[model samples]
Target: MIAILKTGGKQYIVKAGDVLKVEKIEGEPGALVKLDTVLMVSDGSNVQVGAPTVQGAFVEAEIIEQTRGEKVIAFKRRPRHDFKKKIGHRQHLTKIKIKDIKVS
Candidate 1:
């Protein structure tokens, strides 16, 4: 089965045993996190979509690690004025392994 869950203000489509990186969440490695904001669930032929979110539907996951993404550089320059600016950023992220999707 597969499920669409919301976390860190973003939605992800996931299935059991899938490992995904998401915006950082509170949890240590190996911690169990239950995500209840399940928007949709599909079991091969049958699909269930929620009105915002499905009631009594949840996705269980195990936190694998806390990490950061690659740095992104933003640079600006003006040749005549000799003005230059540069900025770099890395997003905090969490890696989680989906254990199960339960719908009642």
Candidate 2:
């Protein structure tokens, strides 16, 4: 089975046993997270697509770790203005493994 779920202002395509990184979620390792904002679910031929989100459908996942993404550098400069700025950023992220997809 395959499913599309939403979290942290983003959407993802996933299936059971798949591991992925998403925006930081508040939980410790091994925490079970239920994602109820499912956009679509499919099992080969049969597909269910929600208007916004599927009712009574959810995906379960286990938090594997909290991590940070690769650093991104932002730099700005002005010609002949003696102005320069440089900033670095790393997005907080969560590693999660999909456990199950269920529709009621």
Candidate 3:
């Protein structure tokens, strides 16, 4: 089975046992997280697409770890003014493994 879910302001297409890195979620390692904003569910030749969301549908996952993404560098410069600025950042992320998708 496959499911499309929304979390942390983003959407993802996933299936059971798939590992994913998503925006930082509030949970500890080994914790169970329930993503309830389900948009679609599918089983091979059968598919169910919801209008915004599927009622009584949810996906379960296990938090693997909290991590940081690779650093991103932003640089800006002016033609002749010698005005240069550089900034670096890393996005916080969480690793999780999809456990189940339940559609009622």
Candidate 4:
């Protein structure tokens, strides 16, 4: 079975045993997090979609690790004015492994 869930203002499609990186969650490694915003679910043969979210539907995940993504450089230049600026950023992220999805 697979489920589409929302967390940290983003949506993700996931299944049991899948590991994914999402916006950083506040917790230690091995922490168990329950995501209640399940948008849709499918059991191979049948599918259920929610108006906003499916009531009583949830996905359980375990925090695997916390990491940061590759740095992104932002550069700005004004050709004739001789003005230049450069900045870099790395986004913090959390890796979680989907343990189970319960649908009611």
Candidate 5:
């Protein structure tokens, strides 16, 4: 079975035993997090979609780790002006392992 869930203002499609990185969540490694915003679910042959979210449908996941993505560099330059600027950024992320999905 697979499910599409929302967390931290983002949506992700996940299945059991799948590990994915999402926006930072408040938890440590091995923490159990229940995702209640289930948008859709499929069970091999049948699919169910919600108007906004499926009631009583949830997905369980375990926090694997909290990390940061690769740094992105932003550079600006002007010809014959000697003006230049450089910046770098990295986004915080949390890795979670999907354990199960319950549909009701």
Candidate 6:
């Protein structure tokens, strides 16, 4: 089965055994997280869509690691002003593997 779930203000299409990187979730490695904001689910010829979210539907995932995205550099300068600013940032992320999708 395949499912669409929402977390960290984003939606993801997931299936069993799929590993994905998403915004940071508060959990340690090897922890199981249940994502219940399921928007849609499909099983071959049958499909189910939710009105916002499907009731009793959830996706189970295991936390693989806590990581960070690549650094982003921002630079600003003013001509003839000798003023410059440089900044860098990296977003916290979590790597997870989908274990199952259950639709009741």
Best by lDDT: 2
Candidate 1, poorest ten consecutive residues by summed lDDT: 19-28
Ranking by TM-score: 2, 3, 4, 6, 1, 5
lDDT per residue as tens, model 1, 1-104 = 99999999999999999999999989999999999999999999999999999999999999999999999999999999989999999999999999999999
TM-score of 4: 0.94
What is the TM-score of candidate 6?
A: 0.93
Candidate with more favorable, higher lDDT: 1 or 6: 6
lDDT of 3 by residue, 23-103 (tens): 999999999999999999999988888898989999999999999999999999999998999999999999999999998
What would the per-residue lDDT of candidate 5 be over residues 1-104, giving only the tens digit for each residue?
Answer: 99999998989999999999999989989999999999999998999999899889999999999999999999999999999999999999999999999997
Worst 10 residues of 5 by lDDT: 47-56
TM per candidate comes to 0.92, 0.97, 0.95, 0.94, 0.90, 0.93
Return the clash pairs for model 4, or none. Answer: none
User: For model 5, which pairs clash?
Assistant: none
Residue pairs with colliding backbones in model 3 are none
Q: How displaced is residue 54 in candidate 5, in Å?
A: 1.2
Candidate 6, residue 4: how far the Cα is off, in Å: 1.0
As for model 6, its CA RMSD to the true structure in angstroms is 1.1
* Of candidates 6 and 2, the better by TM-score: 2
**lDDT accuracy of residue 12 in candidate 3:** 94
Which candidate number would show the highest TM-score if scored against the true structure?
2
Candidate 1: list runs displaced more than 4 Å.
none
Model 6 C-alpha lDDT versus the unseen true structure: 0.96
**lDDT score at residue 13, model 6, on the 0-100 scale:** 93
Local accuracy of candidate 6 as per-residue lDDT tens digits, 1-104: 99999999999999999999999999999999999999999998999999999999999999999999999999999999999999999999999999999998
Model 4 steric clash total: 0
